[model samples]
Target: MTDKAVSTIAELARDFGVTARTIRFYEAEGMISPERQGSQRLYHPRDRVRLKLILRGKRLGFSLAEIREIIDLYDSAPGERGQLDFFLDMIEKRRVDLEQKRRDIDLTLSELAEVERNCRNRLSELAKGREQA
Candidate 1:
């Protein structure tokens, strides 16, 4: 099969709407390996896809270490099934964490609304007192 097209680091960064520094940081973190053309870095299409997944994983609250673990699993020698199982475990854990966060946020919003109502009532009472005076 013919090799896929590769792009310069700058091109990849522009395509992904991320900074070159961010891509380099991922490389430093062992998240991706780009080909080097002298001092310049070239990224294959596979690297581009990996970068996309890395960014998406970050947005989903995955830490760099966690993302690296997941990425490594896919690249592991034993098999993809083991990695798939590990990913499923991670997904389950994240679901629980997200549910807790949702509950906490709901509670916080309710408290905030109560505080706002109290403040409005107090202000209304103060305004009435001033009007009477």
Candidate 2:
């Protein structure tokens, strides 16, 4: 294979800012499939691209199962409009979930602020009582 078409596991890990163990984990999860050269693993360009996509999917908070579904489509439906539609649907679902999480967080933070304010007010009252006593 041409050098441009193949890469070592270390090379891919370094290039992608990931650990060798992370690559191995992805390989184990079937997210990437590197060819075995004796005890060494040689990654093809396709594997490299899949690793990049896997990392991107993780960064976007997608579960491995979801990432696997999307990655599987690359081979199963290359250049198909159906794939685009499916991907768009997934994106909308993710967006709705994330927005709901954001709203929940906002409410939690507001409640925390009110609790903190009450605690501080109580502390000030106690301090004033002690001073007056």
Candidate 3:
């Protein structure tokens, strides 16, 4: 869409593959402010961009408050540099957390496999003993 192109909340939701309620939640949270056209919410290109950023942040495990802080810096005195630095820090933290979670999951899977193997072995031993008896 063009820089000046505007869209309705329904259009934005459809394009973003999100529910209208989700958009409304973001709106209520002061994330995206659409134009009010006699009860209809008309979203402009700027709001659309913000919504995209918000969704991207959510996917990256950032909270709405964090996303808002980053987006606010875009037009604030801190400018692009501050936003980038903050986002990078968030990315690093999230990466570390995710790596720890991966390790935990791997360890759990390994434990499960060992338990299964032991159960299979016990069953096999019982079957052989029954056959001999």
Candidate 4:
């Protein structure tokens, strides 16, 4: 392997910013195919790149299955059109979901503000009652 490639599990994990267990999990999931050198896992440059993409996908809220599908598509066809289309679809769906979540959060915040106001008003009223008493 070249100098840029990872030759051991520790090197792969360090380069990818993941745990060794994560690499093993990805291997078990068939998301990556690393070579075995005397019971030690050796990752090449391609595996390193794939691991990066997988972690990025996870951070972007993509399921493992979805990440695998996207990665497979990219690996199978080294072009932009299909990937762009898929990304556009995913982005639109995520946008709509986020909009709905924003609306829900806004409503919850408004409700919380009302509750806080009411609690403060009640406390003030009770203080006034004690003063009068």
Question: lDDT tens string, model 1, 42-101?
Answer: 898778878987998898888888878887887776557877788788889988999999
- Best by the TM-score measure: 3
Clashes of each: 0, 0, 0, 0
Top candidate (lDDT): 3
lDDT of 2 by residue, 8-79 (tens): 988888888889999999999988999998999999998987898889888988899988888888777564
TM-score of 2: 0.89
Worst 10 residues of 1 by lDDT: 1-10
lDDT of 2: 0.87
60-86, model 3: which lDDT tens digit per residue? 988888899999989877789988998
Ordered list by lDDT, greatest first? 3, 2, 1, 4
RMSD in angstroms, candidate 2?
2.7
Segments of candidate 2 deviating more than 4 angstroms: 1-3, 78-80
Give the per-residue Cα lDDT of candidate 3 at 9: 76
Ranking 2 against 3 by lDDT, winner: 3
lDDT of 3: 0.91
**Candidate 3 vs candidate 4: which has greater TM-score?**
3
Q: What tens-digit string does per-residue lDDT give for candidate 4 at 1-133?
A: 2367556888777766779999899999999998888888778887887888899888878889888877787755655667667867886887798899999999999999999999999999999999999
Total clashes in model 3, counting residue pairs 3 or more apart in sequence or in different chains: 0
lDDT of each: 0.86, 0.87, 0.91, 0.83
